[model samples]
Target: MGRPPGAGAEGTWESALAAHLAFRGAVLDVAGSTRRLSGELSRLGESHWGIAGKAAGLFVPHVEYGQSQLRWIDDELAAATRLAHAAAEVEDPDMQLALLRLAGPRLEAAMMGSMLLAVWFDFLNLTDATLSRHLYSVETLYVKMERWQKMLEPSMSALASLEPEQVESAAEDMPALVGHLTREFASLLDTIHKGAKVLETALVLKESMEALTMLSALRFSLPAMRPALPATLGVGLMVGPNGVMMGTRIVVSAEWVEMMRQLVRAGVLSLPAVSAAVRIQAGHVMMAQGHGDLPRGVRDALGDAPEVRAMRVTGKSGAGMAEPPRHHVMPNEFREWFEKRGFTGKMRIDWFCVTLQQPHHQAIHGGGNWKLGRKWRGEWNQMIMKALRDAEVGAGRMLTQNEILKIVAGYMKLYDIPMNFVRCRGK
Candidate 1:
C-alpha cells in the first residue's frame, strides 16, 4: 500500500508540466500573431540563421514548431501576467497594456485565446505524432542494436579465445570495423545522453512557462471571466484510390483518421469519393468527373437500409443525434482502406470500391445513371501487417484492439494523413 517506487514524484512533475503547458498554450493560442512568439529570438539565441531563412534544418517540422511556439508563448504569457499585476499595483498604464497586449491577438479578439487553443492542441497532436514515430523508430533501433551486440559479443569472445596472430588475421581486412564499432558505441552513448538532456531542457522550459499559467488564478479570482473549454470543429477531406473521398470530422481531441478507420473496420462508413480523389492523385486512371456524389449517396443509401439502421452510430451531430451521414462522421477513405486491410476479424474482404450512381440523360426521355470511379476495400489486415513488419514492430505478434488502433493512428500520422478513417465489417 505504500506508493510505487518513484511514482509520486514522477506523477507530480508530469502533472505540473501538463498544467503549465495547458494554460500557457491556451493563453498564447488566444493571443494569435500579435506579440507573436517568434522563432526569431530562439534562432538568434542559438545563432541558427538557417531556421530564420530557409526554415530548413529545424529539429522539428512545422507542426513541432507550432508546439515550440506554444511553449514559448506560455513562458511569455507568464512573464507578461506578472508584469500586468505589477503595473496594476503601481497604476502604470503602459505596463498594463504590455501585459494585456501579450494576451490579445494581432487584429481580432477571435485570434486570441481560441486560436492559441487551436495551435496548442495542434501542437499536442503533432507531439503525439512525433512520439509515435519516435517510439517505432526507437523500437527498430533497439532491434538493430541487439543484432549488432550479438555480432560484436561473439566476435569479441572469439577474439579473446584466439591466439594473438589469429585475432590480428580476423581483424586485418576489417581494420575499420574496430573503429566503426567504437564510434557507433560512442554515438549511441551520446544519443542517450543528449536525449536525456533534451528531456531535462524541456522540463526546465516547462517550469519557466508555468509562471505564466498562474495568471489563470488571477482570472479565476475575477467574477467577470471564467475558464471554459472552447469548441470548434476543423474538418479535412482524405481522398483514396478510385473516386473515394472520406469526409473526416476532427476535433481538438479526436484522431480523425483513426475514427474513420474504426468505422471502416465496423462496416459503418464508406468513403468512395475520397478514394476517387486519391486514385486521381496516384494517376491510376485519367482524371474523371462526376464521382463526388458517390460517398454522399452511399451514406444516404446505407443509412436507409435496415442493416445500417440497426448499427450503433458512435458519432454525434448538432441535433444531439448519435449518428449522421458517414461522410460527416468519417472523411478519409484512405484511412478506411488502410484499417480494413489490417483488420483481424473473420470478415471476408472485398477489394472493390464503394461507388455511387450519377444521374444522366438517356434516349427516349428516360433518365439513367452511370457508375462512377471506384474505391477499393479489401482484406486490409494482410497488407497492413506487412507494413507494420517493415516498420519493425513485428508482424508476428498479434495486437489488441487498442494497440491496433494506436498503430493505425501512428501510420496515418506518419503519412501525414489529414484524417484517420476506419470502418468495421458488414453484418
Candidate 2:
C-alpha cells in the first residue's frame, strides 16, 4: 500500500488487452532498471546489494496479479469486441457507438471501483503472488547479511591489525580508521532496523485489513473465494513474472475482473449493458463510474462466491430450477493422482464436492468447438496437470491434500474460477 498508483500514460481501457501488456512492459522496465542499480551498489562486493534488492522485490506479487488479470481480460476484450460488432447490426449508429465504447468503458467501470482495496492481504510473504511465493523474507535477510559481512571480513581484519597499536602515528593524529568502520556498521544496522520496521508494519496492516475487510472485495484473502462455498478463493495477480508490482496500478482486483466479465458479456451478448448504455443522455462522459465514493455494497458484492453469485444471477433463490450438478472438487480424471498422495485412508476425494452448473463446467473445459476449445480447455488442464506432476517430482514424493489445494487455489485465480466447494479434510 505504500506504493502509490502507477502514473501510466494517457490511454483508455478500450485497448485493455494492449494496455495490460503495455502496463506489464513498463513495470518490467522499471524493475529491470531498479535491479540494474544494484550493479552500482555491487562495487562494494559485500552482497549488501542483494539484501537491499530483496526489499525492493516486494512488488513481484503485484506483477503476478496484474498478469493473471491480463490473461482473463484478454478473453474479456474479445467478448467486448464481439459485442461492439454485434451492436452495429441490432442498434442505430449512436447506440452502436455507445456499445462499442462498452468494450473498454464497461471494463473500465468494473475495474475502477476495485482500484483501492479497503483491506490489505498480509498473509502473503512480502509480495502479492499466491503461488510460487519466493521473495526475500526477513528471515533470509539475516542469512544474507552474514554472507555480506563475511565478504568484507578479510579486508576488515587487515584494517584491524593496523588500528594504531598505541597511537604511535600520533604525529599524523588522523583518528583511527576503525572508527569510520564503526560508523559504517552503525549505518548498516540502522538501515536493517528500518527495513525490519517496514516488514513489521506490513504485518500489523494485514491484521487491520482483516478486521476491516467487512467492506473489502472478496473474503478470499481471509479464507478463500469459491463460487459454491460459504466463502470464496484467492485469485492470482493482476500481472506477474518480470515486472514491478505496482499493486492496483494495473488491473485493480480479481473482483473487478469478474465484474468486468459480466458487464462485457452483458453489453456484447445481451441487454444489461446495452440498454444501460443507450440511456446515457448526450453530452455525457461515463458519469456512473462513481469511483470517488464507491458505495458500500459494490466492493462487498464483487466476489462471486456461491451465495453472492447466486444472489446476483437471480434476486432470490432458485425455487423451481434444477439444482446445479454435483462434481468432485478434485477432478475425477485425476483420481490416481490423489490416491498416490495422502488422499487414501480417511481422505477420500469424494468427500470434497461442489455444484458446478453444466454450462460453467463446459466453459472451463472449452467443451464447445473442437478447435477453439483446444485453446482454453487444453491449456487449463495442462497447467493443473503440470503443477501437480512437477511438485511431486521435484519433492520426490506424493503431496498432501493441503499442498495440492494450495496448487489448486492458484490456478483457479489465474483462470478466474471460483473455489466454492464442500470439503472434508483428514490426516
Candidate 3:
C-alpha cells in the first residue's frame, strides 16, 4: 500500500493529533472521578459504624488499586502527548513515521487504562448504593427512637457522593475487574446480612415495641438493598447495559490506526506483519481476561478470517496435567500451516508447542512431572506478549515469530527442549 496524497498535510495530521488529545481528556476525566470516589469512601469510613464500618474496610484496598492504575494512565498520556507533538512538527516522512510508531501504542494503552478505570468506578458506585441504603435506614429509625436525626448526619454526607455520573462512569471498565469486585462485594454483603441478623436478635432484650419496630424496618430495608446489589455489583458490569458483550471491546481509535497505515505506506512499518503482531497482542489480552474468542470486528480488522483457529494441543491426560504424556504429538497439517504463515516461533505459539512436549530428559528421568514446567511456560508467554508489544513500537515493525522466541528464550530458559522429541504426526 502506498501513502495516500496529502497524508502529511497539516489538516490530516492535526485531526489525528486531536483524537489523541480527546482520548487523553477522557482518561483524565476517569482519573478525576476515581480520586473523588476514593475521597468519599475515606470520609465515609471516618463517620460510619456497624455495617458501614465493615464495608469501609473492604473498600480500602480497591480504592488504593484504582489510584495506582490512574497514575499509570497519566504517565502513558504524557508520553503520548509528547510523541504526537514531535510527530506533528516533523516534515520528514521517516521522522513522522518514527514518531507515530512511538505514539500509537501509548495512545492505545491510555484508552485501555481509561476503560479499566471506568470499570473500577462502577464498583465504587455499587459500594455507595449499599452504604446509602444503610445510612437511610439508620437516619429513619434513630429519630423514631428519640435519638437525634442529626446524629446520623455524617452518614448522609457520605451518601451525597454517589452521583449519577460517578456511578455511570464505571460502565466501561474491564469485566475481569468487575467480576473480581462483584465477588468481593458479594462476600461483604454476606457479612452485612449476618451483622443485621445479630443486631435484630439483640434488640429483643429491650422488649419494647418501638425497639422491635425499628429492628423490623432495619432488617427489611437491609435485605431490600440486597436485590439492588446484584444488579450493580454482580451482573451489571459483566453484561453491561446491552447484556450481550462480555467484555468492553474499546477498539483502538481510528486516528491511531490511520497513523499506523501511513507509517506502513511510508516504509516505516512492515505491512500485514505489524498488523498480525498487534492483533496477536490484542488476542492475548482478551484471552488473559478469559475471552478466548475474538470479536468479529477485531478479527476483521486483523484480516483474520473465522476459519483460522489458533491451534491448541492438549495432552491426553489433562491440559495442565502433572505428568508428561508418553509421546508428544502435534498435527502435521497444523505444523505446516504455521510454518507457511511465518508463525513458526511466535511467542504464544512457541510457548504452546514447547510446553506440550514431554519435559527435558533430565527432568523426566529425575521424577519431575512437566507441571511446574507448564506453569513456567504460561508465565513466560505472558511476559513475552508484553515484550512483543514493546518491540513492535520500538522497532517500528513487527518482530518475526522466530525473533520473538529468541527474545523470550533469552529471559526464561524454559525453551531448552531437544528437537527430536517434538513430533508432528498426522491424525
Q: Of the candidates shown, which would achieve the greatest lDDT relative to the real structure?
A: 3
The models' CA-based lDDT, in order, is 0.30, 0.35, 0.37
* lDDT score for candidate 2 against the true structure: 0.35
- Which has the better lDDT: candidate 2, or candidate 3? 3
Candidate 1, backbone clash total:
56
Model 2 C-alpha lDDT per residue in residues 155-196, reported as the tens digit of each score: 323322221111112101111222232233334323433443
- Cα miss at 227, model 3 (Å)? 5.6
| Alpha-carbon RMSD to native, per candidate | 29.6, 25.0, 18.2
Query: In candidate 3, how many Å is residue 207 off?
Result: 29
Of candidates 2 and 1, the better by TM-score: 2
Candidate ranking under lDDT, highest first, comes to: 3, 2, 1
Residue-by-residue lDDT tens digits, candidate 3, 1-427: 1233556466545544543344345435434644554564454345344224543354444445555655655665565565455445444333344344434434444444444454344434334444444522443322222222222222222212221121212222233333443344345545444555344432432222122111001111121235322222111112222211221232244433444434333322223322332332232223224333445453343334332222111224366656353332122334553355354431113222323334453253233654554255343334455566687789897665444434533443344442212112221
Per-residue lDDT of 60-116 in model 1, one digit per residue for the tens?
243343444445445544543442333233222222222222222111112222233
Off by over 4 Å in 2: 1-317, 367-380, 423-427
Looking at model 3, which ten-residue stretch has the lowest summed lDDT? 212-221
Looking at model 2, report the run of 10 residues with the lowest lDDT sum: 278-287
For candidate 2, report its TM-score.
Answer: 0.25
Give the residue spans of candidate 3 off by over 4 A: 1-65, 115-178, 190-195, 198-292, 301-427
